[model samples]
Target chain A: MTSDLIAGTPAATGEGPQEMRSRSELTAKEVLREVGSVLRMSEKEASELTSSPVENDEEQTMIINMGPQHPSTHGVLRLMLELQGEKVLRCKPIIGYLHTGMEKQAEELSYMQGGTNVTRMDYVSPLNNELVFSLAVEKLLGIDGDIPERATWMRMLLSELNRMSSHLLFMATNGMDMGAVSMMIYGWREREEVLRFFQKVTGLRMNHNFIRPGGLAADLPAGWRDDVLTILEGLPPRLAEYDILMTNQPIWRERLQGVGVITAEEAVALGTSGPILRSTGVAWDLRRDLPYLKYKEVEFDVIVGSYGDSFDRYAIRLNEIRESMKIVYQILDKMPSGDYRIQDKKVTPPPRARIDESMEALIHHFKIFTEGFKVPEGEVYVGIESPRGEIGCYIVSDGSPKPYRLHMRAPSFVNIQALPHMMRDGLIADAVAVISSIDPVLGEVDR
Target chain B: MSDAVVDSPAPAEQLYGCVVTYSRGEKVIHASRGNYIATLKKAIDDSFTMCTDLTAVDFLIYASTNRQLPSDISGERFEIVLNLISLERRERLRLRVQIAEGEATLPTAFDLFPGTEAMEREVFDMFGIEFEGHPDPSRILMPEDWEGHPLRKDFSVGRIPVQFKGAPS
Candidate 1:
């Protein structure tokens, strides 16, 4: 019973998630103890507890700390929410819990080490972030993505797979937050399959660091194709199961529909991006509209909603999962193999053995490794379509190995700005719906 | 702040050994500061506005390389980058103008684009680049009592100023 409150389970299952066991092992005892301190008090109760009044319920306003520890807040983020009973009056989101100073830290690192730095920004869609940063740098160098047809396809394929995983995680957690018990079970199961695809291709489930400056880290492993195809093939039926279990369900509809509705003008003003912006009747998809990579070759639809409500956000995510899956299927069919890295060894390091044999290779490797290749001094902003929204990297190279300034316009960070606007004078329960609907990752927000 | 920019980066046809690169999600115009805005307007104006960015990068390297370094070097002076984001095109254009290290007087873009009000103030606070005509040109990020521009490449990133944070370093 205590664990259920701690995990926010609406109904009890025989066994908790297996990942929760691993989490218990990884987290420090102090962190777990701190979480326990909060689990002892209900968020609903805490909001009511803060009111300075007699035991009269109507006059008191409650202030609740909605995480930096709780599961549903997504990463280490705390929202100081003011509640007049169950309806939220105001919400002030406190950030910087995950302030790694990734931009400042990137300056200390050379160009080649950029992947290791930026891949952690959007931890869920690491490859997409890595790709955007790399492309911006490469563009500065006047280099194109001339690696291989297959590598580009692989980049697209993995991005779509990652999108599915990201959206599935959102679905699972959003469902759990809204008391849709079975949806969590189904969503997590589907997400696990996508993670398995990442594990096989990049050897890391979350942060692959596979996409690099010139090309991929290396060629895909043998039989990797089969593994991804299997997942893409299996996703549609599972997505349909989710629709039946959650989307079409009347109770799910009631909680989400017409809740926290934002207009297209409001979304633009607040800097909201991704599906949240699209849900507001805006058809601004970076892939179709902006056209990055081989996205021009691949065919897909930009899912838009008439109303920018929680329900529309949910619907867009589902439609995107299907669209992304469709693209993944096409990538598998059209993937052409020739070269993974650029033929110019100056831009890319040679095969591992070339360092031992070739003097030119040795010198090139040393210079590339240490001094790092210089980008011409100028600036270009490349807005790449991430699983979320416009993940753009505006790069200014002073013709140096390290970027002079590294700034990320993260979708989650900008989208989170809309939170207070949507939640003001709304139900306290609606705050969770608004946040979960935004699907923000604190890593990206505070980065 | 109000500024008059004569942005000229050589003759239009003479594309010299200039290699343009983008960095850190900020666009730096990497040309000589003489007539920099006039030239960028010719290049980026019709298709996209060369809106300056949150902060500017003073190419101390380029200034030194070209033997164009300012005589009176102060902590405040650096290059100003125009961070232009296109609403219609959904694109961005970065234009730059270098001011002397000590003297932060440069042409303001508010005359060209009105949305640059917040952006110019940010550059003033972060890099101490004074926009001559920027209305309400004051520190936006740091406190009024704060010393020196915070985002310059020369500005050290370590150590806390006790007076700023209410703690002794």
Candidate 2:
């Protein structure tokens, strides 16, 4: 077996230099090779930066471990940093502290139960995770176009509202990381309003598996429009307060202006999307560029930044909240009244009322809940823009209720790759800012 | 998932010296292990600058039944799925490369898309498919000392032994 072959190899213990190596252990030639390969740069470029040979170095560079437990590292992300006096020479993010083997778990869950599994991956924006998985399953079931108008618009509304709450949380953490302690309270105060609305709608604050495969689990609750309106009405003034507190403050600008900078080419090469990519002046929002659901019908700007620095990323997300508000308002104005889930008997189970009248309805409900509806025997990949970046779902079905294979292309996982390149020349103090700017949820990253 | 029956077969075409098949309206290219990197380079030349995702699927159980592929390419034990998107064209292209169980290795695409570093590591860690030229070819999610490829079908979902009151040992 493959497992035996892998275990049999004596060098199976050769786990590569997973951590950063110290200057004492690496020769000049080896240093050049390691730097060039780790950063994905040419040897010539790497050598030019390390012009002074390793032999003549006065102070030995030190490699230190930063948090799998550091509060500012944002949920158990460990970094192996090689620092010479405060300036970081190399940074390697050591992750998987949160891996519960969700991909393996997905293979055991049915299509109807899969949303509950994926929603927990990115705890901040659970709706988008569920949305992408549902879209992929619907595509495989060949019911992508048959989704009711109300369901599509409802999905859009929930997704946009979740983006707002997610960015609000980022505001809190980013502010806390940057030493603006009061901003954390203010950010959470505003974010609580949004999460309250989510709880009213989805019955949970964080991992709401309300957005199911065919459509939503249930329709909008009573007074949902008013609840959404309350959130919308309450946020603008608080956002303007944020503008005064951080956006225009001199200390805030000074701390983040040029720290952890990345170029447009580098951002694209790093496969970052959403605000990080937009912060590099690449206007690639999957909503505007790809136009899924009712995004095409809505009017909003695809905010982009030219400098690609920490400040650019910060401002991009700050403005994205207002843009999300604009989308939510449009959705409020245009939300169609119809069934929230599809009426396709194959994908959607019989309504609860139907079970009282007919035996077939009870049988269908029991069968659907227990066995789950089967998706076609094909593979499909679906990508949607989450608050962090592009969250993609790839599924292969082998003619069964459970997926043959399920993989989530987590945006935070890829975005964390840019950490090493971003932290290479920055100070150790700025490492927190770099990580906060990337805003990686380690649950998603490790998953 | 559907029952063990083949969907209507579609005609096959070629792109970048590999088979071009569509999976639910998305374009997919079935590249061999030898030309995987070359195909990625060509894709970059054609403006597929951003590699959205790189993942692998273990086909250990579905060796024969319910497998979807073109008539020409034989199904292998492992398939590497690469999803690339062109910002200019706003179109996505998927690349699938097959690897047999005995020789489960392919050249890395890190040179083309540096973002794939972690993803390739993940594929290696989970499915035991080695990328030949990968720099950090170690595990990403799993612990380095882990025993088996957890995602492969052969690797069972393990359980701790349970003790029951009224049962024979």
Instruction: Show model 2 residue runs off by greater than 4 Å.
Output: A1-14, A27-59, B1-11, B63-65, B159-169
Q: Write the per-residue lDDT of candidate 2 for residues A264-330, one digit (tens) a residue.
A: 8888998998888999999999998888897889999999999988999999999999999999999
CA deviation > 4 Å runs, candidate 1: A1-65, B1-91, B94-169
- What tier of docking accuracy does candidate 1 attain? incorrect
What TM-score does candidate 1 get on C-alpha atoms?
Answer: 0.74
Candidate 2 lDDT at B144 equals 61
Q: Model 2 chain A: which ten-residue window has the lowest total lDDT?
A: A1-10
- Score every model by TM-score: 0.74, 0.93
Across B27-126, the per-residue lDDT of candidate 1 in tens digits comes to 3344455565465565544545423234466555444443222232222236565545554676655554557765667766544543354456656665
Q: Per model, how many backbone clashes are there? A: 36, 2
A1-447 in candidate 1: lDDT tens per residue?
133333434222111121112222323332222222122334455455443222224337556788879877888767777666787655656655676557667766767888888889998788889888878877777677465777677778777888889899889989988988778888899899888878877888877778887888778889887888788778878888888888888999999998988777666544456898799887878788667779988889999999889999999999999999888878888899787767677678788798899998999889888788776765556777787777877665666788877766677766675676677667887888888998888788666
